[model samples]
Target: MPIYTVNDQSIHVWEEGASDKQVALLIHGWSSSWFAMSPLFPILSRYRCLAVDLPGYGQSPKGDDPVSIVAYTDLLADLLRQVTDQPAVLIGHSMGGMISLTMSLRHPELIERMVLICPTISGRLSMFINMFLGPLVVLERVPFADRVTSLIETRIWRITDRVMKPASYAERSAISSEAHERIKADVRRPGQGQIRAECYRAMRENDLRGQLQKISHPSLYLWGMEDNTVPLRDASSVVAELPDADLRIIPNAGHWPHFEALVTTQRYVRAFLSTPIKLLKAQF
Candidate 1:
């Protein structure tokens, strides 16, 4: 619930564990808050864990306008600089991964290492859709368009909630009844909708294929084989571009692998961090 002013944006940040140890920043996906990363918090708490609710999500204030992924990356870099002097390990999921990758490529000095989960990168068809169809979709903000877009978003949210509910880990399941209700309450807080809209706008404009080669930090790419949101096919393309990247596929898991398989996800993440970069590369 605490807030910080980074790049003139009021960002919501939560910190746990000792500040003297290595830091890990966990960034959540689109339409998600820090709660999405709750599954790994207990284990990750041994080290410094910082989870952020990006601008326009959770308790953060809305930005002046919609953001680009690169802009979000800059915001994150600025946040890191303001929050801690130590280089932090960046763990990002979905759109969060895009921001992490952008940060790694643009401000490598701030990052010690990275763990990207089902990252969003370029897809030939998605590129065409965003470049062409996206504008048309945004047009829905107009007179009748707003209503239509709202309807569509509502339907999608319902479906996604159903899918995610079952995939939540046991620890989460114990509190499932109240967990989602809490998330909904947080989303309903003032300025959340606008923030989410801006993040979606940013994700649509982000295309990082050209900058992938600039990333020099050691990285781990984790994918859920059954992830329908960011398909496993994208993993090959991501690993191929980064010279120092390793991939791990979690079977029977969906888009939120850490939630679906919390124990496994935590175990791997800790193990990878403890080992040398060379050993991590051999883990895949």
Candidate 2:
């Protein structure tokens, strides 16, 4: 376990695999912890993996400030510097994908490669959501906001466990009941509603579309073809913007391909990492 302070909060890190190989930073999506990325660690043991709790999740402490996507990216950049001198490969899911994209745009030199799983680049959220909830972003400064958010999150967790998560796995039958149970457990971390809500509030707060051309690192866009949660169409457009990128749609996977189609996703991940940077090209 490694702990680092950013914005007055402690971020906990979990390390796995051999340190001799290149570094791979594993970032979990919203309402998750370093443990959420555990499914990929054993398969991708070729590279040293650094997984983070991202404040308010796992054992990490929530800072006095509300969490935003930009804040996450900035903190990650500093954490990257403190962890290793070598450029690292970024592997992010959902909101983690947003942070990784921002990191690549703001600190390109620090990235060697990237793998995004159902990242929300654009066209995911509707204007109605932003219009209704955007003002709540400023309310993060209010002490009572966290209390209200936690109450709302309780209802969300109930619905998510009984409905959302089961629907996320396209090949639900392919995975064990235990796996789905683990996912349900992962999303219900304590006192994390404010971090979760603020992250959603932070989406589209930054414009990263046009700047995708600036990312020269070999990138992989591994998305679920049936991902209704983030939509494959939006991800495809983002992939088109990348200078050197590949897109692989898992036919039988939905939002959480890493868990639903572990073997197939693992194969794609290993093959992508094995390829030389210069030979990296777009593929479906």
Candidate 3:
């Protein structure tokens, strides 16, 4: 693991695989670090794999400005420019999926294909349904609201720390305590709490369904049939909006099919990636 400094932000990155293989960038979800995508590293090691901890999570440093989907995607573009000159595949989970969606739509030339795992489409239900989440949308909209919301956000994170670990794994028999701890421990650290507050606020406020229509790349949507965090109805709706998207529901898996049903998810990813997407090479 190494830290890459770009645009006054320190981003912690994990890279593996050969330089000759296709460049694949991995993005994790909200309140999570790059470790969430660690399961895919080994399986996809045949390709050039790059996983990053966005500012405020894992070992990455946070920026002073309020985090938004655009900021994260801009940082992703910066990292890609530094690593690869060719168009690469973008793989994102949860909040990362939202960022990836905006990135591909905003800068279509930079990305050739995509893999979104149980991504958030429209936040209307996710935010309104949760009592605490509804408040966040208001807090994000009001001036100087972060000052008060920051305290509430920190406390909520502390309270939900333990809950997220188990909530991520729906199939109890397939749980890996080691993997769970490795993926979650750093996120619950003392100072890491408030950084994700802005990201969550932005996620709650944005409706991504309209933006999905702009994406023209081949995309693979892998949803855990048992995912409670992002509902199947929403996932199906997401599939409907994308121009070229394939849906694959993993049975007996939860929000984290990559972790709970590792082999099956890997097989699915490999098949999707191998489907010969017309790589959009850089124009010289």
TM-score of 3: 0.84
Compute each candidate's TM-score over C-alphas. Answer: 0.79, 0.85, 0.84
Q: Give lDDT per model, in order.
A: 0.70, 0.73, 0.75
Off by over 4 Å in 2: 6-8, 18-20, 126-156, 171-173, 281-284
lDDT tens digits by residue: candidate 1, 1-284: 56888767888887788768777999987667888777778777656888999777777766785567887888889888877887889999888888888888888889888988878875222332345434643554355655565557666456435544443222233234465676555534433444455555666577666667777777878887666666665776776776446778887666677866667788888877878757654543
For model 1, the superposed segments whose C-alpha errors exceed 4 Å read: 123-194, 277-284
RMSD of each: 4.8, 3.7, 4.3
- Cα shift from native, residue 188, model 3 (Å): 1.1
Name the candidate, 1 or 3, with the larger TM-score value: 3
Query: For residues 190-217, could you state the per-residue lDDT of candidate 2 as single tens digits?
Result: 6655665666666756556666777666
lDDT of 1 at 124: 24
Model 3 per-residue lDDT tens digits across residues 1-284: 77888788898988888777778989998768888888887668667988888988887878877777888888889888887888888999988888788888777878878889888777433422255444554454454765565557667566566456445556552648787667666555545545655665677676687667667777888988877667777786775775346789998787789988888899998888776664422110
Candidate ranking (lDDT, best to worst)? 3, 2, 1
Clash pairs, candidate 2, are none
